[model samples]
Target: MEDLRGAFAIVTGAAQGLGYAIARAYAQEGMRLALMDVQAERLAQVADELNAQGGDALPLVVDLADAADTERAAAQALAHFGTPRVLVHNAAILINRPFSELTLADWQREVNVILQAAFLLTKAVWPLMVTAGRGSLVYVSSMSGIKGFVNESAYCTAKHGLEGFMKCMALEGRPHNIAANTITPGMYMHTPMSERNYPDELKQKWVDPMLLTPAFVFLARQDATGVTGERLNAWELSTNPPA
Candidate 1:
């Protein structure tokens, strides 16, 4: 495997959950990091942890839903650690209400936070990737994007839209050596969100968080060249990953 030492990377929603795990994985590999989240307090602690471990890390606290906020996040990240060689759009908001009960604001907020945020971040980073001639954007989409579920209309819609956006980005970005892909993780264990919503009665279905870090490292590696527009599942890859 190629060494990621000195490579700069960005992981959105890095204050907790899968995003935190992703940051740890990258830091272990010696990647300089720019971690973004809306939770300012949590972001501080995460940064301290990474820095204590001798990883170069910068934490940005901003609401990702606003276009200007996302723009600033991208700018601040680049300013702090130079341009990121890898960008992971792992932040998402889930609305678990019945279709009939969902409001316009609920739908719009989900779309703005999930899809628009990714677009803004990608657009901000594209010029840098073009200059460097190498970059990758990974979207942490959901299985809901592929298959529907009840009471998650807004979440499903945003995730499905991400697929289409990623495909187009992959096609256009390939010429600039900027690849785009998505990862749909199975039910994750011990994330902040999971801890909040998962009940003891439903613990049987939760997937181990440790199993996810490897695939992330692999996908973001230099050897992952030409692997654009692909959607990978962590569970499927654990047993029979693509070569």
Candidate 2:
């Protein structure tokens, strides 16, 4: 485990699912948090839970699709938490529609949430991280980012774009003691989104998220040196039962 006692962090899409899990992991290690999302009620609930665990967590609700809104949201995070040492771009949207039936707006919106939002958030915090001379930026990508998936053209394109974007950021940010890495998590069980897509029978056979939080903590810590522009898979990393 890496020492992160004084670090401050920000997690987007933190209302539920992967975002919430990431935030909780940081909180457990005593990292102050800025949780941003569109879901006010659930976002607040997450914040409260972190606070209950004796973690400092701030909630900021904003629509990432709007450029100005995303920029403003980042500003809010900085104002509330000072310069964050860790930034996780975990918010994303998926439109599961066949290529022939997908609309132009659907494609645009999907890309906007993943690619544009990451750009805006990173840009907003760039100066702060530069001034601190140390920071970590983690992008929550998917297997789709590295490969293709049915009914996932828009999502896949946007996630693949993140790989390129994060690599470039890693190169530029490295000179400033900042690292950027992307994690391409495979399908997992038990998230708000999963409640909609996963059946009860399938949940038992999927990867449990608890097993992956440690990697997230490592990435956000100082010990993750020289680990930039890399992609990780949770299921593969956690397969220890002779699978």
Candidate 3:
């Protein structure tokens, strides 16, 4: 595995849930972090905690749904830590409503956060990665990307788009030594968002978000020669790492 110590990583939606877990894991590896989230207060709290633990972290408050905000966040991150070796596009919004009830506004909101933001952020960071000739771009995907689910029209569509986008990135980034891939948690976790949608009983049966961190860490450390354009299951990767 590549050494992560002293490397810079940018993780979006890092104020809570899987994003927070990914940031925490990176901090433990002694990696410097740029943590972005729409929640300013919570993002600050996470950064503070990491700093207290002797980790280098910067909190960037941003609404990914806004193109300008996404661009600004990327610029701030690059300014703080030039050309992050790892970029995790984990910011997303889920609007669960029946197909008939979903409005154009709801669909647009979901698509902006889940798809457009990824494009903008990646575009912002692309030149830096090319200059470095080594970088990892990880899209936090879901089963919804591959399978349709009721009441998740917007989310599923966005994720499906993300999957295709990552593949194109992988192909284009090959010559530059930038690896782009997708990782699916494959099980529900007891996150703040999930708690709002899942019953306590159901949440108890789901895997911990932390369990999915290994795959992320692994991908971050890898170069383009490693793995790209692949959809990996976090749960399986955590149990048995790819050879």
Candidate 4:
């Protein structure tokens, strides 16, 4: 893999959870980062922590459900850091409401965070990556991406669309040496979302999200020739990256 020291990265949902872990991992690699999240105070705390560790960190608060906000944040990152070596769209919200109980607003909120923001962010980065001749794109996906679940129609639909989007981008990215891929945690994680939604059985099996950051660090160094289009399992790749 190429050296990522001083390289740029953009990570969404970076205030906490897997996104936080990924940002920490990238900082360890000596990468500069733009950390985007909806939680302003928490996001600022995260940036301060990384910055104190001798990392260059920028915090951008954004409500990704709003297109204009999403576009503005993406523009800010690009304006500040130029083209990023990797862009990780890790932000998503899962509200478990039965189809009967779901409101259109709730549906839109979940879908927009997972799918719409992915598009706007990727679209913003596409030209820069193409001009730079290489970049990596990672969309955090889950089992919902490929399978249906009760009380997760909106979340599932968005995840499903995210994976499909990655595939198409991967194909388009090939000639430019850009890589686009989706990754599943492949293990129950001890994140706020999982804490709220996990069954007792799965919570017992949950691992720290930090344990999965190795997979993301690996993804950050990729170009189309290394990996693209596949749905990767973080547990497997983090433990044993391919030679």
Candidate 4, which ten residues in sequence have the lowest lDDT sum?
A: 234-243
How many pairs collide in each candidate, listed in order? 0, 0, 0, 0
Those runs of model 4 whose alpha carbons end farther than 4 Å from true positions after fitting are none
Candidate 1 lDDT over 40-65, as tens digits, reads: 99999999999999999999998888
Q: What would the per-residue lDDT of candidate 2 be over residues 90-199, giving only the tens digit for each residue?
A: 89888888999999999988898899999999998889889888888889898778899888999999999999998898889878988998886665657766667666
Best by TM-score: 4
In terms of TM-score, which candidate is stronger, 1 or 4?
A: 4
Q: Where does candidate 2 clash, by residue pair?
A: none
lDDT by residue for model 4 (27-69), tens:
9999999999999999999999999999999999999999999
- Ranked candidates (lDDT, high to low): 4, 3, 1, 2
What's every prediction's RMSD, in angstroms?
1.9, 2.9, 1.1, 0.7
Point to the candidate with the largest lDDT.
Answer: 4
Worst 10 residues of 3 by lDDT: 195-204
Backbone clash tally (model 2): 0
* Per-candidate local distance difference test: 0.84, 0.83, 0.91, 0.96
Give the distance in Å from residue 34's predicted Cα in candidate 2 to where it truly belongs. Answer: 0.5
The TM-score between candidate 4 and the true structure equals 0.99
Residue 149 in model 2: lDDT: 88
